[model samples]
Target: MFFRLNMKLFMFFLAWAFALLASSLASAATVEQIFKVQNRTIKRLCNERVIVTVNGLFPGPTINVHEGDTVIVHVFNEAPYNITIHWHGVFQLFSGWADGPEYVTQCPISSGNNYTYKFKVQNQEGTLWWHAHASVLRATVHGAFIIHPRSGQFPFPKPYKQIPIILGDWYNAGVEDMEKALAAGGRPELSSSFTINGLPGDIFSCSQKGQNSETFKMKVKQGKTYMLRMVNAVLELHLFVTLANHNFTVVAVDATYTDPYVTDVIVIAPGQTLDALFTANQPIGSYYMVASPYKSGGKMFDNITSRGIVVYDHQYAQYSSSHLVMPSLPSLNPMMPFLPPFNDTPTAHKFYSNITSLVGAPHWVPVPLEVDEHMFITVGLNLQRCDPATVTNDTCKGPMNHTLSPSMNNESFVLPKGRGYSMLEAFFENMSGVYTTDFPSKPPVMFDFTNPDIRFDLNLIFAPKSTKVKKLKFNSTVEIVFQNTAFIHTDNHAMHLHGFNFHVLAQGFGNFDPTSDEAKFNLVNPQIRNTIGVPVGGWAVIRFQANNPGVWFVHCHVEHHTHRGFNMAFEVENGPTLSTSLTPPPADLPKC
Candidate 1:
């Protein structure tokens, strides 16, 4: 009896040990995905057009992972052009090689080559996205990257369902051809149509005929809350979104949790994401959700509205029609769900200012108390003299044989060739001629930044091109006043930081007055984000700690502005400890 009892106890202990091992292995498993980029003909808006896509998925594939998971993506670029994928809003802590801005972090994956991006998602949980960082491929090569809370419980109440709504633009002309045309100093042509989940919704004229014509639709049950993760992937437009007869309580932005704020309309600029929760308490009916462009600079844009549908599941049963009757939805004309005016700066300002960080949240970081570095940068559109050899009567659009050239300060950034070395690699190797650390702390010349009549002098509007970066010591606190200049054109610009999310200290229209505006800074519980839109002809103050060591890209998120050279980089020195320093580059980093 004693021997039998001993054996039973030993077996129980062994089973417990095996169970613990299995759980540990499951938690530490790496999430890997293989993406194949190829050119395929896809039918959209009633026309068949060839587009570059990943794994033949129109909007690519949605990558869902929990927080603290290691994501490994092997991208095989079979397309005709080079490509690079940027995980937008991922902190990429100590892993700058995977931060995927061509030439800045790593070289672009060349045509017909493969590169593997491996990075761990640390301390971030919310909605983010990934998109092509090379040329204009992001139009179709984009998808949602949703990070669930690692603790298995969200900060707010769990919702009945979660959905991703990706807003994008469609261009009729070939994207590469468009880039070449702009390079030749021609006027920019706007996108032909806007899309929801790669579908130009039913409201579009071209979407009415094709057998595959589709619109994004969501069915909800009454009295249940749903979380919508909305991403603005449009290249050059700020979008105003509305859901008919419903209001949303915004829970987060750019993957950072925020105190709930309720609003009827949400204004999201390119590269911005919003996570909102709304209870389906309205009357049982179908409603139309709308997305329209909010033109800030009076520039011509695609004036059409993209539509999606939301229906109460029981509404079909209420109709009691054997013919599968469709519930009446609001008319698309005039957009029933009202939006603010196209240039309503006040509305946009209110939405941005009201979002305060949720203190004590899992990822909350307090605003830095003292700043070691302060930068006052001016970003806006400028002009440069067009080369006579490449200029023609049809090509030169700006005044005095010049063309549109956007810049940060007086220097328009030019990407370094680097001989196939990334900026971080070049810095660590002590290589010269890759990039300079003389990026100005303030604008070279300052005038009334909001003056509307400042475009008279062609020389003043011309910005010289260079690749400049700002260097900072490890663990330093940095503050920046991102002042938007109206020299050539006054428009809203969304600025994105690659490696960290900063606190939006304050933002307001007109020039940012140091004396008065200093008092308005929210030192406590300021909203944290990786991207914040500097208001049109206005300014924003942001603060962050340079704890992560590496080369980080700071630039306007608008693809047009970024392509036109409105960008700079930050080089942070390594800390005293190895754990705080940057890890060595992976063996499979892409070559130029």
Candidate 2:
């Protein structure tokens, strides 16, 4: 059914492309400039001034192309730092060679250097973005890459007007300093503010420096429907997005147009994108447009960050004129509260065990993954060995639970030599837990995700007695279950695989019972997704065909979890690349 659905969608898109081609052709444009960035704010006192940017913008430019047009993006890195452009979610189906992530696919374009990424836009009309695929710099490097419909038709309903809203979180700390801290054995402080585009504070709050902080603003007509393309580009945190007094129909998710789900509130995680249409139905009044954190772990942190607000007006003008109002979005759900800091009573232990058991029940399974390979990946938290003087910041004490440090196995991977432009690029390449450079060619050294532990103890460490390596043949039919070792913050981890989407086999907590869970597997109507949650202390099994050529990535989707080393890489040798158009990076690319 999924194969048929994909085929039908593909054909429809092709027809739509023909229509678009008949209606209009795209004009190519070159946008370039130098941007000035500074980390002078008191909050980010540790950051340094950076002249790194393309066309004078952190995200370079929005490359607007048609479904069949070719895009040439030249990035010149003038910054003191190394940089590279990664077109995220741009399924390089036949052109996986240019699918950026620095080391994983291609080498990074260095500072004072330039590289051009050229690719044919073959995807159906949808929302996608680009960012620095190297190191932690993605924090500062990212922007929307909008593809208009080809001459024909669109996959989703066309709105009167489209707005590109890139949601991100900004830290005053310098990107280098923050990454250094995280790399040098310490937890980086939680961001004090989240921004829309790049604005903060209540939309109307005056900045401490006497000027108003920029708020993510939008203009809308009261009657016409508007399409908001929202991308949660922030590395960490899931967002619960809601419009004040107005409801929206989610037209698409992760760029895949869905059967529009209507709701006033929508939750999406990092690396996920949503396209929603709002009719601007609120009365002629100002209301907050908010995105708050979807609390998984952590104490009830009341911290609220508002992107901006929607101002509804009775204006019937051609263009709705309005200003953005940033507010502190309040949380509708509080975190599970914390009890006494110190506790070891029998009741407390029993209560904790019961709570763990209750939460450890059947982790919902999405559906069957129809692929050629099944691989088990491990995800857990581990302590970082760091110099006490340099690594131990006041924000966290001894690692493991206090800080949500996650890892795949105990070994936090380091990228092998000669993959990307710089060490930073190499570091980010390992974000997917699986580091190709260092990973063994055979099956994993440890396959514990299939274990039957109901709950992994927070402080307990699980080490395999045997270091003997096990190897699984590439492309073999397999079933690999992932068990979360609740060592880190005991929160569910969304396991995502790059290069292909898979069917959800089965999932549950309390030592996944092979017979029981398998019996419950929905051979039909099971949700097939590229990413699925491996419950904390629970297990999830995923199966897929390793048919696609090139190295693939599998890791936790929680951005922070990824940082702590829940990643690994798989190589799929010699498979037929899909018959699709793909382009190469352009020459004369500008330097950041």
| Candidate with best lDDT | 1
Least accurate 10 contiguous residues by lDDT in model 2: 352-361
lDDT of 2 by residue, 1-592 (tens): 9999999999999988876656445523233323322222232222334524445554445666666666655556666665666666665555555566555556656655666566566544567777665667767677887766654344445688888777777665566676665654445546656667656635334432244446555666566789888877766665666676677787655444444557656655566666788886654445567766654554423255655656544344333357554333223221121122221122222221111001111222233345444444566665544344554464344353233345565545444434323222223233433232444332344334434342354334433211111223434444567766645345556666666544455666655666678886645433334556565457766665544445555666555556555666655544333332223323342322
TM-score of each: 0.91, 0.70
Each model's C-alpha lDDT?
0.85, 0.53
Q: Listing every candidate in turn, what is its Cα RMSD in Å to the true structure after a full C-alpha superposition?
A: 5.4, 10.3
Give stretches of model 1 more than 4 Å off: 1-27, 209-211, 315-335, 387-390, 393-395
Model 2 error, position 434 (Å): 13
Largest TM-score belongs to which candidate? 1
